[model samples]
Target chain A: MKTRIFSLAGIAVLLALCIAAPQMLDAYSLGVALQLLSWIALTQSWVTFSGLTGYVSLGHAVFYGLGAYVMALLWQSAPLWEILLGSGFAGALLALVIGYPALRVSGPYFVILTLGLSEFFKYIVIAVEAGLESSGRLIFGAPDPETLYYIMLLLAVVATLLTWGLARSRWGAGLRAIREDETAAETLGVPVTFLKIAAFVISAFIPGVVGAVWVLRTTYFEPMQLFSPTTSFTIVTMAIIGGSDRAPGPIFGAAFIVLLSELLWARAPHVYLVILGVLLVSFVLFVPKGISGQLAWLMRRRRA
Target chain B: MNLKSIALRAATASAAMLLAATAFAVEPVKVGVGIAQTGMFAPAAIPALNAYKMWADDLNASGGLDVAGTKRPVKLIVYDDQSDFTKDAAIYEKLITDDKVDLLLSPYATPAHFAIVGVLERYKFPMMGSTAASVQLKAVKPGNIWFPTSALPDVMGPELVKLMKAQNIKTVAISTLQSPFAQEVEKYLKMALKDSGIKLLSSVEYAPDIRDMTSIVSKMKSEQPDATFSLSFPGDSVLFMKAAREQGLSAPFQFVLVGPSAAFFSKIFGKNLDGIVTMGHWSPYQTKWPKAMPFFEEYSKRYNETPDYLDVALAYMSCEITQAAVAKVGLDHDKLRKEISSATFDTIDGPVKFDGVSNASTPTMFLQNQEGKPQIIWPASDATSTFQKKGPWAN
Candidate 1:
């Protein structure tokens, strides 16, 4: 009861800080905060599906790219809320279409297929844009950064809650069962394919919305840039660094990377990348459970 | 008083004067920019960065940048945007809101430039842009940012057709990179070709990350057109060049849209690079622009490599315009914007005057790699040398 109360209090404080960010922070810090929220939202969504199912995905960028494309297409023509909704729908629809076949495979094959499908979709978008003879797009008169920040904050909160809720649900347990022993879970009467697809679709929705909001920050969209593999790579890196085992892992991970980059990029851009590489290697080799897991272990030890 | 006492008094007085001067030296002007220090666009962006660096060095060497009557040293606040448009925009916002830089410099690439227009508008900051050209730039509201490049795709398209017509070339095959600038140029080129009654044998568009030009070059070879125009960026230009050479697709009037002017291109191709025409408006061989050769020589001497004829020239020219404007009206944003838009500043590319965001003075021109040197080959007035057909590829 004490632990639950403390957790609730911590979440409340975090929510307050996010709400006060636009009022308190300067433009640059607000931009950083927006970036942090975006990563948090994306990583949390990834954790909801990949963390629970043990089916690692390397193509979350596809949903994000699709969302941004939908935003670009419907930018000024539709209302702001409609554009965002349309973007989210585009991502969810794509996820639903790709999930059934994609979830059939497991482990490395699933990872590879997700990546391949992402690339295939990227080329398809490119070809579509080319056929239209539109090379790129720039969004004029995008809402100010402050407005975008609030939207991102909402997404981040919802994503975190969704992950938290799903992690404790019976559905999460069944997914974990599939991760441990798929045949046994199937024999136990778990709807493995349906659960996996649902999780995949749930994971994809937020990233899509996040991508739409992100593009407004730049107001420029090129297919190659929007669908870059680096986005996927960064998402996976954050998940690994943050510890994908818990609901709060993505928050810790996103904050760590964003703050570290903010502190170092201005001073030493290249060195920051090198340090990131070193940290990633160290985490994979030594601290396999990541920051959140390590923290949990420390807490248990203290109680003991 | 003894002679020793008199000498000591004189020395003390001179030392005191020196200290006072040091204390009173004007504060440096903080000019901020976010450029691609790493990632895909680095190869193209580094030249622009070098140009900015060279300009600062030269100004400091000559008693700093002239701010009205007083001379203030320039301190450039540079951030690496990593060739990401969104990151580039964020860096600009940081530079404006956090760093609080006094002046602004443009970032590299068309997309990065387009990304920051909102920030520029929001802050009412004026910047002189370089290395970015597109038809869409004209659509941007004309106050905060001005493009010094005369190589607008719409203009270049018709000019290219005129140049081809001048050389008596008829049938042409075109291949383009599916990038905004490249594709825009391709669109206009096709329109111009159609308008001018030039027969288009074939047209192909390749993805920006395309590596194999085997099929594209083969298709061009099969057509056997009189001219082949590869509207490509640096990386793809190299791919197209290699594929063309290996496949021996020797269209006499071959024009690669970009990448020939970079120092690496010549180093890579050497004699084979000769006779290939590329887009550029500036050259050292143009004696009319007296400052051109000296700027070229100084850049070459400082960097131990040849500057990109198009990007570097435009980058340095932006600095010149910025310096000239600052010298006229101190670092006031409104005054700088007005001066930049209205004033006819003398640049290495000759007199540059912006008429609503685009450089109205500099002519849209092309350059050819003639015997390992970039020579102006179009718009007779700007041509340092006449146009030439492609020679046989080196073995």
Candidate 2:
């Protein structure tokens, strides 16, 4: 009871800070904060499936790219709320369609399949755009930085709360059981396929929404930029580096990586990635469970 | 009382002195540039960055830009966009809102520049596109943005078609990377080719990073066109050329858009580039413009290498135009933009006059590679050498 109250209080304080950030900070800081929120949302979405189920996705950027395109295509005609909701639904439908076939395969095969799916989607979009004879960066008028910051912050908060809530529920237990031993969990009548698909769909929806919001902030989208494989690599790396098993781990990981990259990119643009690689490797070697897991382990040790 | 009186007097006197110093000192004009210093666009963007830095250094050395009556040094605030459009937008936003730069220089390529148009328009910062020359930019038509030394594909197409017609070229094969600029070029070239007594035998658009062009070359070879034209980046241009050479495919006339400007092509192709035609905006060999030779000499002296006209000459001319405008208008963005739009400036690339859409009508030179060097070979007055009608492999 005490821990639950503390967590709620901490969340409330964090929410308050995020709400005040746009007003309190300058445009540069707000921009950075918006990116941080985006990464948090993306990392948490990745964690929803990969964290509990141990199904690492390398092509999650497909949903993001698709969501961005949907928003870009509809921005002029539709209301902003409709665009966001539509993109989320689009992502959920895609996830359901792809997940049914993809969930059947496990391990590296599934990872490769997801990667291939993203590449396939990229080429398909390019071909369609070519067919229409439209081949330039699409720019939608962007919302002000403050409004974008709020939307991104709201998405990040909602994604975190959903992940936190789901992690403690019975669904979470089944997923965890599946991750530990899929055949044993199946023998115990866990409805393994349903749980996996559910997690994948939920994960897919959040990134789609985030991507829609990102398109609003960015105001421009090219197929290559939107569907970049680098985005998928960054998202997965953040989730793993943060501690994939815990709900808060991805948030921690995302914040560290985004802030570090942003800070270093301005001063040392060339070797920033190399520096980040070193840090990621060092963290993995020293604390295999990530920051949240290490902290939890330390607390348990102190209690014992 | 005596001690407090002395301290108060000392503080007041120091404040007065500081105010006097501040009043006399000229504030530096801040110029912001977001270029791809790393990543895929680095090969083109880095040279532009170096050229801009050199321009700033030279201006500061000459007692700065003459703004009104006072001389104000330019302070450049540059950031790497890592060749990502989204990052370019964010960095430009920061440059506008936070750094509060007085002027803006465009990112190196069309896509990156296109990405930040909204931000530039929203902030009403006038930008001079130095390296980008896509016709698609005209569709945006932001009044504040200017392209000084670059010509759109539509403008270049008619000239190229006329040149080809003069050469008695009957059939042509065209290929391009599926980028916005390349697409625009291909579209305009086809339109120009219509009813010009020239047949387009084959046109193919390949994916951006396609390594092998053997199939495309073979198809073009089979068509047996009089001429082959490809609009691609440096790497892809080299790939296509290598593939054509390996397949023993040749046309009476062949033109590539990018590779001839760089030393990389000369090093790789050597004598194979002889008689091949390529398009460029400026060349060191063009001595008609008085500033061309001096600019070339200065750049070579500073950089310890021969400068590509696309990277150095065009970027330097952009800075010169900016300096001239700022000098005339004294840092008022609206007045400076008007001055730039309404006036004709004599740059190192010759006369620059913007069309209704603020797109410059710069001349596009078609040069022929002769003994590992390019010489202007078209547009009779600018031609230093005649166009070669046939290549070594021509049947």
Candidate 3:
């Protein structure tokens, strides 16, 4: 039954994407969707690690930036597949390294540490690596556009699939247990350490890969741009709005925010940021399970 | 968001049918105008786009941009990229494939338009870009596909470099936008000024939200260079001036600010900007075009405000080109491109033509910031304001 639902939903979404792609020959709408796609990938990764496992990441932009840099470096040097694998490995490796020390920390400390780590990357890219000189070495180059777009789309899909796969896995069950009660999970021999490490690493991997794709698409990189606190907040808000732990939460959150951004931003053209912040707060306070989360709960309730 | 596809389909079917009729009837010239009508880069885009519309209306007033004696009304196909390069690319594809516009007026931002330029070049569309700042964008292989309409920093940088050297004030410092457009220009400016025996004390890439650069300014002040250089935009420009003044910091006799957008930098900063040096976009006094007086008069009267240099630079120049092209080429599309490429016309900005590189235009004056207004201080002859020897804010 679960497998059949997955097939049906995936086919529906795929059909929607395929039909929509050709129809969107105009630039205005497609561009918004592309940006939303980037955030969707980012927040879903956040949802996978933080929402499902209850381990919030404040510095997820670090992964995006890392991905951007790696993809930028790989462009023109490697083929498309090689760039993807290389970016994924680089992000996964960075996540694992950070995860070892990071996932062990508790409460707000983990949050602060993650943010600090993200900032460290930001400063390194902007201040130290400004103009692509990092410790007397050139580290990044802008990737070709079509190559970057295809890679980013691929990464978003792969990350989405990974999210679905993890949700039904043993590790996912362990994460749920850990979220409910870390002490009890440990007492139950759920391998809390491995589960946390795995979750953190996977979360980092998605954003990192996405970041690399971003840099490639831009063909330009400045550290402060990819590693900023605003980028992290945007991702977190998307995850929260989407019902962090659900399959479609991040997608819905990203779409909702992207729409608000288009209308408010188009109207004002000066500052939609304050508006976005207010909407996020209101959604959290009143919307309960976010748009997708609420829908999921309602559908279940109707079934009961 | 999902409505984008449906919208695209509707726009294509309707717009193509509308355009095809006029195009078949008398071959009405199709002009492409690209802007960030949607995304993250929309702020700068809205004002910049006013120039395109202003030009369209002005050119259309003369019964449209003329080509030879066969006068055909010009059509403007406006597209909103929603501030995405991917979308910009897609639109360029449609503009080339379906609409088949004769010429393209690009968006305001550097990164988005820069990417769009790559796509346009592929399809061989004649494009005029004004808002991009990347110096590399100017170096495109000599052709009529793209022309840099505004006075780019690459040309202006060298002109300013001459001013900085003449002053003999050695140490220089700078900050630039983290955007690809700025990144490309910053790359060239740094390289061009590298061998000029100037010591750049610090070069920072700061976010647009720098309220007051208390630390960066103070740190620079401690070193005490003869002059300071900045490659920042509007919001940061005000903050830098205020912070530099509040901290009683005077690092440079000149400030080559990139995005002062009109001579309003001085007006915004008040007396604090007296000695501040900057660049000019389009000084009314500098222009010799016939329509300059009327256009300025109309803008001032309608808006109840003075016309600034940046808009005057783009608005007048684009309208001037459209007029010249229409007069030369009648109503044919390909002929319009040829006319635009073949003829060098006098504009409000001065006699200008695309020099093959979509980046470089005829270089304009590098004015010093006197009383916050970038008065033409160089070339001694074009000096509009009496050389206020060391502005009030100058040490």
Candidate 4:
């Protein structure tokens, strides 16, 4: 009970800090904070589905790209809230449509299928844009950085709450059971397919919105870039580095990567990715449970 | 000592002190640029980056960036965009808010350029964009950013059709890469071809990451069109050139959209690259632009190789225009912006005046690879050499 109260207070403090960041930080720091919030939202959403279920999705970019596409298409046509809503809806709808068949596969096959599907969708978008003869679209006069930052913070908070709530629920246990042994979980009447699809759909919603906001942030969209495979790769890398098994893991992951990128990119752009690769490899090998997991372990050891 | 000698000594001492004081008073202008220094875009960006470096070096050698008569040395704060738009935007934000650079130069490609338009708009900081051309540039707000390239797809498309018509080309086959710039060019070229009464034999579009052009080349060979247009970027340009050479796909009026003007293309293709028409306006062989050859020679001497005729020329021209504009109005944002918008600054490509975002004075022109040199071959006025039919593949 004491630990639970402490955790809740810690979360509240973190939320307050996030809320104050735009006002307190310099423009560059605020931009970096915005990036941090974006990654936190993305990684948290990924954790909701991929983390709890141990699905290890590598096609997370599809949702992000599709969301951006919807936002790009309806940019000036719709209100900000409506465009964001439409983007989220587009991502959810895509998840629902693809999730059924995709959830049937497991392990490496599922991973490859997700990766391939995103690539297929990327090309399709490319083809559609080419056919329309509107190669890429640019958004003008997007919401100020402060507005985007606040929205992103809301998303990150919501995603964190969703993951934290879900992880502590009965459904969360059932999802973990499926991860441990899918056949056993299905036989035990866990409603495996339904839960998987639901989680997948839930996970896609925020990333879609993140993508919409990101397109606004960049003020330009090219299908190739929006649907880049590296985005998906980075998401998975962050998840693994931060600990994919729990809600708090992604928060640590996002912070670590965003902060490292900030510190390294300006000073040593060429060697930044190389160092990230090394760290990612080290985390996977040594601290497999990630920073959160390591922290939890240390706390438990001290208590014992 | 005599009174005349003493008086002269005093005058010389004060003059030297005044000169030193004047030099000390002017701070170095912190010019910033975020470019693709690494990743896939790096190969294309190197020439532009080199041009920026060379321009700064040249300016420093000639005293400094002449900021309204008080010559301030340029201190370029360059960041590697890593070929990501978000990173590119962040770099720009850092450059503006943190680095507090006085002037801004453009990032490399069309997408990166478009990415930073919002930042430029928000800061109300004006930038001279090079190595970017799209019809969409017109849609951008006219004050903060200006593109100096004459290679707009809308303009180049009709110009290419006109050039082809001059050669009495009746039929054309087009293979375009599925990139924004390439696709836009293809769309315009098709519209122009339709209007020109030119026959469209076949048109194919390939993905950007395509590894082989064997099938695309084979299909083009079967059509046997009078003209073949490979609307490709540098990578695919090399692929198309190699495949066309190997498959012996010959067309008299062969035009490769981008690559042939790049130095690497001539290096890779050698004598075979001759007579291949490509998109570029400024050429060293054009004696009309006095600064062109000296720039070409100096860049070649410095880099130990020929520069990319298209990108390097555009990059240097942007720097020259920026230098000229800064020289007139110093670093005051409003003054500099007004000066850039209204002024007709001399560039290596000749006099450049902006009517909105596009270059008003420089006509969209094409270059043909003639005997190892990229020579202006179109629009008659800018043509250094008469149009030549592409010869058979050397293979």
lDDT string for model 1 (A260-286, tens) is 999898889778899999989999898
- A188-287: candidate 3 lDDT, tens digit per residue: 9999998888888887777877776666544454555556677788888888787777767887888888888767643564467778778788988998
Each model's iRMS? 0.9, 1.7, 6.9, 0.9
How well does candidate 3 match the true structure in TM-score terms? 0.79
Off by over 4 Å in 2: B1-24, B371-373, B376-386, B393-395
Instruction: Report the lDDT tens digits of candidate 4 across residue range A1-304.
Output: 9999998899789889888888899888999999988998899999999999999898889999998999899998989999998898889899999999999999999999999999999999999999899979999989999999998988988998899999999989989998999999999999999999999999999989999999999999999999998888888888889998888888899899999988898899889999999999999899999999999999999999
DockQ of each: 0.75, 0.42, 0.14, 0.84
Alpha-carbon deviation at B208 in model 3, angstroms: 5.5
Predicted model with the maximum DockQ: 4
Error of 4 at B89 (Å): 1.8
Chain A TM-scores for all candidates read 0.98, 0.96, 0.88, 0.98
Arrange candidates, best TM-score first: 4, 1, 2, 3
Q: What are the per-residue Cα lDDT tens digits for candidate 3 across B1-395? A: 58999999999999989976764677667877657775555655655666666667765676655666655667788777666554455566656666777766766655555555556545555555565545555444444345544446556667666767777767777767554444444665677688888777877777555566888777777877777666666667667776777777766464745545453554566666556666554555554445556666666575454455564466446656756776776535567567667678777666777655542445556555554444666545555564343433422
Clashing pairs in 4: none
lDDT of 2 by residue, A62-174 (tens): 88988998998888787888998899888888999999998999999989999999888887877677666666656546677788788888889888877887889899999
Model 1 Cα shift for residue A22 (angstroms): 1.5
The TM-score of candidate 4 is 0.98
**Pairs clashing in candidate 2?**
none
